[model samples]
Target: MADERATTVAGNDAEDLSFALSCLAAGAITPEELKGWIQLALEQSRELPARVFELFAPGLANALVPGWRGLIGTWPGTSLSAAEGRAVAGIAHARFPELQPGGAGAPDRAAASAALRESPAIRDRFARVFPSIRVPDEGEAGVGCADAAESGAGAEPDPAPIWWLAGAEDSPLAPANAQRIFDDRRTAGDLTTMLESDAGSTLVLVTNRARVMIMLTGLGGESGHATDPLADGLSGGFLLDNGQEDEYRDRDTVALPRALAVIDHILTHSAPPAQGWSVEVEG
Candidate 1:
């Protein structure tokens, strides 16, 4: 028991030092000052020197701690500030060389988000990752609303494609209706039908890679709360501290999280599980 506690303490201390080193490498701190600090930390302690090597040198820590996984949770959709994101990006770049977390300063975020808004690659990934929520059938060549009418196939308006492929086509509460809900501050009449039926809330998840979706029910109730399990099961999520009204807060915090939770539940706890999708292992 004591040995296990000591190992846990050592691991925590290592993470702290790693984060500090990453911050310094990102220029959030001075390299010279960090060098001095690292030297002092190393000289004063027995384990910290090994810890520093574990953090800065790749494959070393994994060798030392068998079956170890780095960090158990992802932040609620890249919630890190520019400085914070840059720090992590720096560390990821140095260590993994393949990962590139997005931020305000990253051109890749804009490009990838835009591409995901239309890309079939994203939709495919979404289906594989979370399958309980129905993925919309892509139209021929995935032409948008402007071209769909010209092609003269389905008269019903389709939901606008976003990052994670949620929402439906020809539902009374279509993409335009969602726009009205966001912009006009009124639920669509068709949406009311779903509410009356006790169906879940319409949910959307947007990431640089894809848009994921699940429905949230009971939005019409007095409590105005709905749930989805997949989203709820996620380790962390974007949250609002100031009653969700602060301009600094992402608006998704209001509608996205609960809807995500419902989706999570459906995907993970639903009977038989969806084919080609598996439950995420608990860390």
Candidate 2:
């Protein structure tokens, strides 16, 4: 965490954040301590770090935890929200890199390679579709023709090829409409349909990245409130006394500890496993 941080909109100011970061740097506050503070800041305000907090604490945490970080996310979405869990942890851990439970980050080569080996499946997928891929006669307008994109008689090809052959010009799409990946015997056809669907299906990629992702998700309810997991003290976060009451009572002494439950919820459930990658969260 730098001494000079970009300003934040979550009511917490740069000065407070910078002080928290400084305390974090000086070991006055542990990683978990700093995380407790950030989670409080995130939950009460229900802000996305993207739209709100910008700094990655303790200065540069990893090269940035990669792949499938979020999808169709919003403030209220934190109800059982996987995106929120990952975001909070990522922001907190980055600021305190010294003792991350993890050491390094990499993909699950065995699983990734296995997925890569299935490239042949792509060809198999196109085999039937290709026969139906009609090239509109050069001069004739075949309005109903299922061209290349429909099966390859158009300007674009399957983008998956470009990712492998040319290497991605950028990373994969994220914060996308949640996707559901169904791994079944229907092979390519089933997958194609699933990929295009609106509802969600879980086929996540897990990496033992130094930046931790709170693996415990979905404990709260879908409606976003009635069964909210953090509903007790956290649902209505408190402001520091800041002499606001003029009673001279120490608000932080009590208010700050409330954040521990959220911190503990994350710590209790998160088990990143070994330092490698896998295709799914280890059940």
Candidate 3:
């Protein structure tokens, strides 16, 4: 079963790579654009995309060199669009010309839904890591915190936990802040301590316009001011920061779920070791 899951993940990666390549070939995306996607994939699982390519498609792996290195640095831009999603699927189909047809070229909504059906491993891992947030599906309406508050007028409201790093000052987890978090060992250690101290606390980080709620399960005992803390046991998603208005006009609906999946993957597969800490999304 483990082997089967590995194979399935590899196949899914191939589809993703093929889709990326297809998008590149179709002139719908540039290499830089593809790199952004690869970066997001890496954040989800350090071993992936590269590992998938190295194991199954070594030739393509070599092709993605230095540009793929970008994944190690800072967070890139937003998630792909529905049209881009279709292009990714299309490219996957094109790569494996021998695969069955009809489901290859277009983005299948069912596939997205199926992917959301959490696997037992993912569910168990999430349960162990931290409390889970019930995020609304894309395009759902009136589910924001304000709406929830209004609806529960007569009852004691059950608000979700909102954790933030001290001195974060409600700043968005933009590229600059992410870089700082990655670079400052003192800050990283402090954050790690905070995460370790609170099991249910969700550390809120922000991108330029999105809010990333991260939950950390463990921060290994290594004491030195290392460069990247929270290396493992980090998973997050983009959701409306509760009570904050939609501040960014150009919002990408897909970013949060994608970020969440990446965090979950890191927690499940690359948990921090007991003696030494490891950072998953350093670059």
Candidate 4:
């Protein structure tokens, strides 16, 4: 039954991808439209990365299109071996030629790994998303002096951090609606309140990636004052503070860690906030 269900899902995804590609080729669909469809396709199938590589291998040039990079760059590392991951990265490098050494995309693995290890912001984000990766020595970097003193004095070790991926698409919610949600004074206040309530809460708003808007949710839900997850008509999911397994669902939920890694890599290698997104960190 599982195999049959998987086959059906794969078939549906293929049809969706084909339709989107045809629409794109015919100029009947905009790049944003095609991107949304691609995201939806990715959300439905875990086999998508390999399938995409196989399908686009014959015409590697198709991956060069801007709309395709988000899918290609954010391909799950678990889905591909190291060699396969590098191969996909190589294709992305070809597409953006700027990713070559000394080009805009030139941050080597060493630098990125080091940033992941040392940068307070990156480390904090990683701790929230992958609690298992957090060790005692390095994890304390983000702790406040008072908190550290308290821990040293007698308090129990802090609880693990919770991380969530918040996302909005142009389909379910239009751009104007998005702007309104972000712009609303009440919503802004609510977000502020959430951040203030939890010292570990962090929010990263992604605006410029096609028609996608993504944010990170950290530990900040007080009693009787939880932030509405669907305020922006966006969907979300989280990596539990206690490090529970996640049944990958939508792109935002499944791709949270990879998305953050991509964002970090881009920020480390590329220029300023030209990608039409801004990140806000609290705590």
C-alpha TM-score for every candidate: 0.19, 0.20, 0.26, 0.22
Ranking by TM-score: 3, 4, 2, 1
lDDT of 3: 0.32
TM-score of 1: 0.19
- The lDDT values for all models are 0.30, 0.26, 0.32, 0.31
Among all candidates shown, the one with the greatest lDDT: 3
1-283 in candidate 1: lDDT tens per residue? 0111111113334543444344433332233223323433443345543334433332332221221123212111223345444333332232222234445555242233234344444344333322322332324222232234445755664332221123333344423233324222222211111211113333322221111222232222212122222222222222222223212122222232223223333322222113312232335
- In model 2, which regions exceed 4 Å deviation? 1-12, 46-283
**Residue 151 lDDT in candidate 3:** 48
Model 2 poorest ten-residue lDDT run:
191-200
Q: Runs in model 3 with CA error above 4 Å?
A: 1-15, 21-164, 170-172, 179-183, 186-201, 204-283
Model 4 TM-score, 2 decimals: 0.22
Score candidate 2 by TM-score against the native. Answer: 0.20
